[model samples]
Target: MSVRQAQGPAGRGTRPGLWREGLAALRSGDLRLIWLAQVVSQLGDGVFTLGIVVLTVELTASGLALSGTLMAQLLPYALLGAPAGALADRWNRRLTMVASDIARGLVVALLPLLHLTGWLHAWMIPVVAFLLTTGGLFFDPAKNALVPTVTPAGALVRVNALLAGTRQVLFIAAPALGGVLAAAFGTMTLFWIDAASFFLSAAILARMRVSGRVPALTPGPPSPRPSATPLPQGGRGAGGEGSPVRGHLLRDVQEGLRYVWRVPVLRLMVIVGTFINFILSPLPVILPLLFLTVLGLGTAAFGTALSFIFAGFLLGVAFVGVSGSRIHLGYLTTAAMAVAGLAVLALGAGPPLTVIHLIGLAGGAAVGIMEVAETTVLQRESTDAVRGRVFALYESVSQGGRAVSVALAGALSDRVGLRAMVYAVGALTLACAVLLALSPPVRRLARG
Candidate 1:
């Protein structure tokens, strides 16, 4: 059932020729199917998001209507993500993922069918989006948790990097494809296409064999300081023989939070991740104002800038694949945040369009590198018992921060003026970076 390949330390097998390892994982066997399932599902996601926006707008003729659907997409992760993670840890990961995919596909299938039959309502757009994304809240953490178990330990960095890279690539491609399909054949057609993709993803995952349902962590001491300083792994839990988790869901949620609170590094990561999501999140709203009004650029120019930022992200990650293990993990993450702040500061300087694009690229690259570095560290340091919960908490809070930031920025931009708002964001980010740099505990943490 496992991929028939030599498993070695990620350093020896994945470090030297990381891309090769990722390709090897993808070019053959069970890993290939796992990777394909993710790719198929994500492409579907991109298309669905774009098509839905168009469809909702056509039905309601309001940008606010589109925003409602977007909020629906986000609400599940914000509200149910913790519970979803607890379930992932307690259940068979393979089945959790497969079931989620099937359910989401079915929900999405109803959109186009209902529309065709004149049963679709404008209100249903958000309702369906909420249901589909709720499936994602479960599916994402389960799939990520499965990777370290299935792949060589050393290759973890490469595999994680590839998974992230796949999603980002589609962020660019799938939307374009969706726009084309929706424009040519109508948004309902795009929904049908997305529904089909989800079914395909479920089918691929159903056959991919990965170890599932490790014994869950028995509840640690319910105190500010748990009995275990560094949470123990390698007992019956975490791929070993142990009692199944029958713990209260609330207790499981609290365990995940306490674990993060106790780890100095994890706390630092939370601080940094929250700021990163919050500060950078407003760029989409801010960019149009900057380019169209401030810079006197066409909409085409705004799109080009976005392309530049995403390209930089890809390139930064490409560098990470090569230098991942060799770099000091904590230091690289801290330094990347600091550098990103500098780039954002430059962005606020009202430079030429070319220079602005360059700044955006550098900022994005730094942020991208930080993303992989911290994820690898978390994967390495946390035990399998709490990994899903850890990732889910990370996803939830980061997303919640982004949502808050967009609203905050929209409120402030007109009051302070676009340029000043950009300056304020840059200043805050730079200050946060300085704060992290000054923390002795953060500085002393183990280097890469």
Candidate 2:
């Protein structure tokens, strides 16, 4: 594979040049189809979440009931992420994704059918949520592992930016769309729409022409020692022997863990990523309290303020896609974390509404930068053979951190006061940024 030099510092190029580079990934037909499928499926997901929330509220008045639904959605990621990721490497990637979508689509459609038949029950809501996310556990690793194969190596960052941008846009748009549709029809209608979206996504993925195999690694960037060699097509056995079928699933999972621990860059990334997720997890719980109590704002203003975060995320992804390649990923990640810490600190200061909105934007942008940097580097660093398992371990720990942190944040805020909680989060984030900056391995992760 040939290498493309990183452009000079991001803003040195003309505006047109930046825009061209940002949009270049869309020129691949396979990526376009995948992007389209993602847009539809994510929209459906947003609707499904809203519908579940509405249904849960109607079922019970207790807040714990609502929290249980969230826990149900997160459980699969913690329990099955590593195994699912290993399976993605072992199986055909496209087929795994398609099967996941189809399975989820059918399961989702059952909600409305159950309602129509007078069999819908409150207990079923959390069950359905768990099952839906379980399918995603399999789908995500396959999709993430497949992207590098279909896209040109140089455009990988740009492609990741495009996909992340879509999520941000949908984050802002989906609620309003779901609300309007729900008011016009019922919440059950949202489920039907969500079901159809999954089917459509499956149909789109089915049309892609690639073989859906994790191809053997060609000579490119240096890989971490020992994991540098590619596994046979089906993966290796416990004794490093070739097997037409994958080795024991547990062994495959263990290999992924060992690879990350052996690779300095990946090990650091996973550590930092988990810490970052924990620090930021409070936003969802604290933001509402901050707006309603600290800022003396109404629900309408709170919603408006939330949009700034997603908008800032869009801006941040655009920046990375267009000009971020000029900076070493380690330096970029450290800078972004510093900015995020400052934004959180600003929030803790109890400024007026406009200032708070700006903080949200800055914080969101910082998160976007961190996300793209880590994902792109992870893809570049790991071999295709173990990529799925690596992603799975990272994802599993990240989700667990967020889940535990959110619960801890709520408890800590209750004890220390919300402002103090915010201050602590900001301080810890800055400390982590400093640590990243001081690490030699992290700073050395320069562009190829």
Prediction 1 TM-score vs. true = 0.90
Best candidate per lDDT, number?
2
**Model 1: CA > 4 A from native:** 1-28, 218-243
Each model's lDDT = 0.76, 0.82
Q: RMSD to native for every prediction?
A: 4.4, 3.3
lDDT of 1 by residue, 116-149 (tens): 7999999999999999988999898887777777
Provide TM-scores for the models. Answer: 0.90, 0.92
Model 1: residue 336 alpha-carbon error in angstroms: 1.8
Off by over 4 Å in 2: 1-18, 216-245
Question: What clash count goes with each model?
Answer: 6, 0
Worst 10 residues of 2 by lDDT: 235-244
Encode model 2's per-residue lDDT on 1-448: one tens digit a residue. 4224433343355666556655666877788889999999999988887988998888776588889988888888889889999888787888999999999999999899999999998888889999998999889888887887787546677788888989878766787899999999989999998999999999999999887865443334334433243443334533221122456999889878887887788889999999999888987898789778976788988887778888888989988877665567778889999999999989889888899789889988998988988898788777776788878888999998888988887888888888888888899999999999998767566523
